[model samples]
Target: MSRSQRPIVAFLYDFDKTLCTTDMEDYAFIPSLGMTPAEFWPEANGFGRENRMDGILAYMYTMIRESEKRGLPFTRADLVEKGREIVLFPGVQDWFGRINAFGETQGVQVEHYVISSGLREIIEGSAISGAFKEIYASEFYYDAAGRPVWPKLTVNFTAKTQFVYRINKGVLDVSNDRDLNASMPDDSKRVPFTNMIYIGDGLSDVPCMKMMRAYGGQAIAVYQESNRSGVEDLLAKGRVDFIFPADYSEGTELDRTAKNILRRMAISDALAEENQEQLRAIGRDELPNQARLF
Candidate 1:
């Protein structure tokens, strides 16, 4: 198929647990602060609860304060350097390439994106950072001296939904709210909801998963052994379509299910296009009544 003829399918993922084994900060950032994950997370949560601050911002702030106490530099470079220590889940390192290849063979153009509450700079430092077309996450703005000063962006759970819309409209720039909110025709949008899939781990991802369910997309929850029951709850509640071990290895349930979804979306796109063509053939401008087909 020609470039324009190929249907575009998007895979949107949460970074922390969906792709990696644990929270991004647990890898190296917390350790560098001379604090364990147990201590750091609780303190951050406590601060948020006491001050009525957003949890994501509270953690970012805690990072800066703790770094200062330890005489560690909280520069963008420092945080990114910590990302080097992140350990991705099994098969994650090669998952994108294989999925992209499979999509190509299916006449689908695959695009990957990360909508996370973790630090964007840290994700940028990871080995698979370049695989995503866009990474929407919390970020800190540095001062003239290159010291972290303020939160540039904080993507809490609910805020994650906007990035889904951004991906749908191809308005990737986080700073551009005007165009993101502008009304646009469904067909004119870049990628249809039906062609999108969202993969997330837990509660922080509920809003995005719900968006996928409400809209025509598919949502998958990947879980670790410790969180299997929580993930089961999500599936039982019909909040997600499927749950799999946080493994992306070839032949794994996740890998197979993802491919199946891609194929289904590809077939749906083809059918919708053929229906439109049939309408145009008969010189009818009225929208085809076959919306139920796709």
Candidate 2:
């Protein structure tokens, strides 16, 4: 189907804590290197401090450095293998289908996306990878030997918001920044900001959360018991529209809220479409004297 034809509602997610309990790397890859999270992070952070490198790049570099020292093959395939072992939070496995079916009932197409700073290979290896229309995340470039050698892309907090615009413009290709930056009328856009829903964890999500508020989109913050205080502060400050537990189980608060948001967006879109049709249907004879559409 053409991009303009479908009334699309996008659910953009932050993968790590929002979709799963902990960071994806912490789940399997770090342990594979025989260093605890505590030992590994400080070393990675120290390397960043010493080199003045970006934190995301520092971590990506650390992944390659540690893998080589351990004599482990650091290919895209290797990270994906580690991804398979990563555990997900409650009911995440079934969440997408349930949400998609709910969207169908609302007469809108629900498109899922992952906009993360995590490794793309790891995310690609994830069990839930198939759920997303696109995964915008950090990725490594392969050498001639097809081994991951350098960071091809690193999507930090600020970088993530660009993908949101890409989705809005229907310019899915990451290389196409020209069209994304081009000024298009609100009505010409593929997905209106009001039709987008961003789901993220905590601090790092602030940029996109604020973006949603500035635009017409909605942002939802999900948290665990340990991070409930942080999420509450976000709510108190009005950085996000709502906060819910990361639970995606059937009929849970998160699921229910998502459905309601979808319902509202669908109704809003349908009303807008009806108004547009009526305006287009108005004849030259009916313009000034008599009102045909009431």
Candidate 3:
């Protein structure tokens, strides 16, 4: 289908456990500090426990402190380079293209997005980073010397929900245009919530998953096969539209489910458009009668 005629279907994903099997930092960054995941997490958690700090903030602080102690460079570029080593789940590299191709066949435009609490710089280093139209994730600020200075943006569970609205209103930048978020009518938004599909795992994604589902979007709560019990729990609670194994293989449950969703959304959009055109034609036909009275 031509670009002008394509119906938009947005696939919003949570990183960490959703896309990658493990947390991105645990894959490379923590190990690069010469500490095991267990060791680093305990210390980080201890600090959070002692200070009553947010877990995400504590982790960021731990990264900076530990990197400094290990004499590892803590620059933005260094973080991005570490991200390059982050491993993805099975079939992830081809998942985007496959989904996009399916969308094309269904006359829809499949757009991907990342709404992650993970560091943005590192995600940018990932092989599949180019697949997303926009990434809403935590990021650090740099000093005049271009060194990582501080966390400029920290996307926690609730904060990540804001990006959902931004996506709806076509507001890409996090730093500007407050009115876009505050005053834009729902009808004027770029993509309706019903056109969205959110994929996530675990508790950090609960708020986002709930928000999407509440707003007419579908949410999938994915879990490893070994963790079928958790999937059952989520399904019972109605927290997700569906539950699927974390497996991303082509023709797997995930792949087939997503394809079916796109097809359904395309049919809905086509029907809506047909109705609109019929209304216009009716109005045109009635114009002659109204003009005769005038």
Candidate 4:
């Protein structure tokens, strides 16, 4: 098949732990509160437990509340600026382009997406943000003065599943488009489940990993070398299609797995198309009535 005729592979990644070493907020925001991650996280969790607030919302609220107490600006720009300092795992900067180019060689289109609970503004400001086709993540609301006032969207584990549907339907807006989300036929969706590849880490990604795998998509559970036990557990539980080191460096396990998956997906797509064409040819030659349907 020609390059233009190749199928598109959707590479969906969970950002916090899968792509980066730590949560974006903990990198700068939590420390800026003059508290350790241990100290700040427990307070956030306490608020969630007491008020029944969503954990993500509680964290965002804590960020704003603490910033005010410290006389620091809680502006969206401030958060984004802090995001710029958040470091990525090895080879992340070149991973996207490398994978995209590799996909071309395999006769596939590679599109990257971020399905994360991290701050959208922060991710947008990160060095590797431009590689993604869409960023489905938490975001904050701003006041008239452009200062962040409250959490606008608090993406959680289950909420992450909605992004898979959004990617399928090509819907970017989180609001005001109910029918497309509710009524689109599965075949009419832009990216089929079989062409999706999800990369994630830890329990926070269980919902997404399970959903993608259940729907014929592939899910990879990634972990640091020290977390081999956790990676093994995910594989044993059959929560992912594969497991590998979090490293994205070229020639690493992750890089090899990803390239192989893309190649296989392309082959599968080509075989399906070939089978369809054969069926059409058979219909044209032997069944006049069925030929019309083709």
Between prediction 1 and prediction 2, which has the larger lDDT?
A: 1
**Deviating ranges (above 4 Å) for candidate 4:** 1-5, 282-294
Residue-level lDDT for 47 in candidate 3: 99
- To one decimal, what is the Cα RMSD in angstroms of model 2 from the true structure? 4.0
Q: Mark the 10 consecutive residues where model 4 has the least summed lDDT.
A: 285-294
| Total colliding residue pairs, candidate 1 | 0
Error of 3 at 242 (Å): 0.9
Per-residue CA lDDT of candidate 3, range 1-294, in tens? 223766788999999878888889887888889999999989998999999988778888889899888888578887789888887888888999999999999988899999998899999999999999999988888997767778898998888888888788888788866755478755457777878999998677788789877877889978877667877788799888898888787999999999998888888777666655666768743222112110
**Residue-by-residue lDDT tens digits, candidate 4, 255-276:** 9988988888888777666656
Q: Best by TM-score, which number?
A: 1
- Give the alpha carbon lDDT tens digit for every residue of 110-142 in model 2: 999999999888988889999999999999999
TM-score of 4: 0.91
Question: Compared with the true structure, what per-residue lDDT tens digits does model 1 show for residues 1-294?
Answer: 233778899999999988888899999999888899999999999999999999999999999888888888778888899899989999999999999999999989999999999999999999999999999999999998778989999999999999999999989999999999999978778987888999999888999999999988999999999999999999999999999999999999999999999989988877777767777779976344348244
Pairs clashing in candidate 2? none
Residue 129 CA error for candidate 2 (Å)?
Answer: 0.4
User: How many steric clashes does model 4 contain?
Assistant: 0
**Whose lDDT is greatest here?**
1
Higher-scoring candidate on TM-score, 2 or 4: 2
**Candidate 1 minimal-lDDT segment of 10 residues:** 285-294
Model 4, C-alpha of 120: deviation from truth (Å): 0.7
